[model samples]
Target: METVINLFMEKLRNNKGVGLFYFSGHGVQHEGENYLIPVGASRVLRAADQLRYKAVAAGFVLASMKAAGNEVNLIILDACRNAPFKSGFKGDMIPPGLTTMPTVPGALIAYAASPGGVAMNGSGRNSPYVKHLIAWMEKPQLSLNDILRNVRRAVHKETNGIQSPGYYDELNEAFYFNQQVAVNDLAEQQRLAKEKEKLQRQQAELQAERDRLAGEKKAIKKEKARLQAEKERLARQRERDSTPITPTGSKKVFRDRLKDGSLGPEMIRIKGGSFRMGDIQGGGDSDEKPVHSVSVARFAMGRYEVTVGEFRQFVNATGYKTDAEKKGSCYTWVGGNSGKNWRNLGFSQTNTHPVVCVSWNDATAYAKWLSQQTGHTYRLPTEAQWEYAARAGTTTSRYWGNDPNDACRYANVHDNTSKQKNQGFSWTHHNCTDGYAQTAPVGRFKPNAFDLFDMLGNVWEWTCSKYEDNYNGEENRCAGRKSGSLWALRGGAWYYLPGFVRAASRGRNSHDDRNYYVGLRLARLL
Candidate 1:
């Protein structure tokens, strides 16, 4: 099979003439992929995995033919028999029949039957589909598309709708077979046929043009909506700025710790102030577009991220099962399904380490449980609140300054320790080392001006705000979920690059998608 594929590829690349390929054998379609069984291949297919080694993928064959530089190519498969290996398969039980191929320039793929229907191999010298196809090709001056349509009609009439042929064609130039005698008669027939095809193609082109214009109109409408959202956000910011400063309506600024019982993490009071939110550098993503003013009221935020010990306390009290624990899988930095979770993160972490692999929903549940236990309103911080705290009254890219060389002193990120431990494998890392490869113990790094630790790098902290493409005025408030929307994430993780640690950077994920680089930070009203 390999040799045959190689030879066919060679013909396609070197031969300038038309290439016609015909296959007549058993075939199967699984999960939208069609595979052709070679004559000498295995007959017993118990699972989709075994088929990979025993059959040639039709998509690969078509791709090779496309790159072969042939003026035109035709691939006909008469092997849509739905028998021989129809048992013992689990999951995505092989689709009933061969699927349709995508349209490619200068190429046509014709099947013996419509997609997902069994083609009758007719107990004779040839199948009805192939017999009619041969007869139609012999007829003079019939374009390939016309010939296929005629064959499809004849087969449908003969089989009474039990079997119908189908094809995907993108042929621009017309070519006909068996063109001899009565040259003028043949020329006139070809002219009329070509004219009809020209009109049909023009109609299709016109429809395509209309679709393109409609898409442009939709894009314009979206832009208008985004601009309106921006204007409203700016207006709200102006209103906030003109208003007097207050801490939850209290005139006095609260700078001390606020706590109830041992149910929730300790919170530090942040003074009420106004600052320019979003990316001030003008180098951020579209989501951070049109950097605008924002005013935040005083709120108590966790001094450090929720720790393993704290999360354990929540679970011990509530007997709650995390989404990852329930599903038995979590996404890790290496990739998904690395067998890592909050309990076992493939790294050494004491009770002091921030909890990882907790989904947004799990974090929200934890906050709710804490609120119930402490008799206070506890929830994930809003996106505005997170950025305000992370900035710590600074206007630079980071709370410290624009320079990233001083990052190791502020937070633990992908650094020299990670490079040496992972055999120099790093997506983006800093030159300095933070003494930890994965996650560091909570409060290991120095706190910002507001006494917030690990505010930029550690594990991403979940926010209560649902994610938006840009910061609309609505997102400035504690926005709720919109149907199936992903929740917003803030701060960068140890495995991320220095750029992602910027104060304005944002991330998001499904509410139930737990990951090793995602965790929780508690927040509550003052």
Candidate 2:
């Protein structure tokens, strides 16, 4: 089964057009994870782990499709018949029916029965779900969504609500099973015209709502500015009340003045410290091996990931184009989408959201521009410094703790909210919801022990150190930004799974690679 999936994935990678995968067999759920059972698999069901090893993991199939990066992919599973291992499995160890899986970008997965519900093996030749699916699929010009909706309705009626078809869709564009249009039919043409007119009306309504939201956003920004001014005034007053001190004894939080006299990003003072670097916790990757002690000098680091508003100010002042803008695209879940940059992400973003789609070079340039504006030494943190700050005196997988379930309180990661919004794509997400599907406003969640926001998730932060397979002296110092060097990226992004959101997890990309999942934070010599 794995070999078959691999071959299908390879074919999908080679094909630029649409791809479709359909399976008809027995499927089961083990501990909330779905699996498809191949023929003669009942012999290997002595243990739960054995079944896991033998059965085809539905997640692996979904992930392979995502990795293939096809434009449109469809998966139909008529495998929700009664469990094949009911005699061998005990209790809920092997559930009665298959579990639901998320859809990847530009893909959809349809099931013969609603998630966690059983389906009849069919008294007739075909199950009710498959029968309706076939009937609806043959209809011309019916979209996949429409066909599935019809199938669900028909199956519910046929089974008297005992079974209903289900689907997870993450497609950005409509896909029709039959592309033929009834152009000669006058009634069909009039119906199409009316549909187009209705779509235009909806678009107009959306534009009006967007305009209203824009006005509200402007008002909120003004209010936020007023509040920030008040906070700054209080901070200044407190500074004046205390004795002036050197960088080594500076206050916990401080901000520098920009060239326009506006305050820059809030900086948190990190005291000099020595600690073990690399994956202290077990289950980390090989790159995070060889844990060694490293000492960092006293410095100030950004309290939050750099915001869209902050990056915009630099762009406005310098008229600097980001690497994404220059390259004409940024990598997204769907692949490199043309014209998708920081200013024009496919989704909506407020000014407070952390700026993404900026490459390592762009990040470094922003740091340089900031240093010029503030007359302070600003740069990306060394790999060790970032890990140290992120760890914040913790030895756990994350500063919050080992359990990924508690992630919603500490950081914005792939969670229940994301699963609900991006119903396409399968991943093990945090058990909780952080009230955001994508990037949340910086500092929305609770900060770590070091009072740093989004150190683990929101967007991957670039470091000044080059990536190496194993720990060397490079982790402690900045590597020269020579071409073809792979710079290290710390933290994770909104779309990251539980394993990738750990403090010790490391990622690397070329300096010029711009992605929607990457951003930056700056550190300064205090």
Candidate 3:
């Protein structure tokens, strides 16, 4: 299976066309992880560690395919056979069949059965799935997704109540197995060309108008800031005058109102206080210069990065599509390409793993939905708030300390796993073994002083703050500011080095740019 996967990757890399990977074997889901079993692999059933090492991870295969740069990739798994070694393993270790595979960018993973359901092995040579797939695949002008739907319908009918096929399609462009281009009528083509030209002209005019408005807005903002500073000065004086007297050593913690685990995240109370919110030691970016004091109010923040399962529930309930999903592409480590989206993050993520490939807009949308559902205003943490929470009353590079050796114990940084995966690139991993090449499941490592898990790694988290050249008057806003320019993301990801994964470190991306390494966690007002 590994050799076959290698061959597929080689072919995909060498060609600029579509690629297909069809597997017919035993597949199983073991504790939410999907595996493709090769011939005679059941012998290692009792040795759990050996079995994992021997079997081909579906995630690994998909990751390779994603990196291969294929125009389109199709994966057919008619391998959802029943758990052959169920008796030897623990009851929960093996599910009835393969678990659901998430959508992959520029690829489709079609299963013979719905996740956790058994696939039928026909008495004849080929299974019902294979038979229908072959027939539908040969149909002229039918798209791959369309053909799969037809195949799914046929397989369901043939198996009766025994089986139902499922698919995760991430294709952004139409692909026909048998290419047939229709001739265009001359008159209709001319009319369409004129319409296109008109639309282009209108778009150009609209862009000019936007540019003019933006210039005017910038000028007005400068004037507003001048007056706003004086207004804020008086407001601050008023705020100071009305301050309630409290004991010097006083502390407070605010917990979430909803603890049912269905409506919102499990939050940890952050007892806000005055903290110097930037890189004090000259070891960080220029943006982190002139370490300034910031005062914050008490609030609650997610204990861990929002997981894939949590986001799935939001999507299912609200029918909300992520920006990447709507735009049909997102940035990956390799670069931007069509078909990459939040659903297909170029790597596999279990329910507990952090959700990635989400834009700032998508994060805000999720926050809005969560707020509406829970009746608590959920929003992204402010840059200052995130720094305050992550610091946990500490001023070190991380909440723990400045030692890179301690990284894997508390957070997942670019480690031995990532170095091994990309030998050609120079990796400044902490040299610790975090046991994950990509994003790890949330809370895999120890929590910080605030009891917040994954505040520094697994994925860069979106904050409500918009990016500024340097901190100026923006620090006063507790909820952070939003701008048309780039937005801020705090924390570093599993792929970044320990240097970038600091409590005071800052990263920014365009508001609309979604990448596999970026995710979000919400903050709720106390």
Best by TM-score, which number? 2
- Scored by CA lDDT, what does every candidate get? 0.76, 0.81, 0.75
Q: What's the best-to-worst order under lDDT?
A: 2, 1, 3
lDDT of 3 at 194: 95
Question: Model 2, 418-491: lDDT tens per residue?
Answer: 86676333346787667678889998766788889999989999999998878988888898878767888899
Clashing pairs in 2: 103-424, 103-425, 104-425
Each candidate's TM vs. the true structure? 0.55, 0.58, 0.51
Lowest lDDT 10-residue stretch of candidate 2: 84-93
What is the per-residue lDDT of model 3 for residues 1-526, given as tens digits with 9 covering 90 to 100?
7888888788889886777777888777766678888887765554345557888888778888888887688888888865433221311124456887676668888899887666766644478888898988877789888988898889889887567888888888877887756548989778887997999899999989988887898789657744654554455457457756434343433333433455467777677689888987666776786688899998888888999998988888879888888889875643224788867766777898999988888898888888877778889988888889999988888888888766766787787657656422233577555667788989767677787888898899988876666898454453333455667778988767566789888877767777777899988887
Ranking by TM-score: 2, 1, 3
RMSD of 2: 16.4
Tens-digit lDDT track of model 1 for 346-392: 66778899999898889989888877776688899988889999999
Stretches off by above 4 angstroms in model 2 are: 1-133, 136-250, 334-336
Between the candidate structures 2 and 3, which one is better when assessed by lDDT? 2
lDDT of 3 at 332: 60
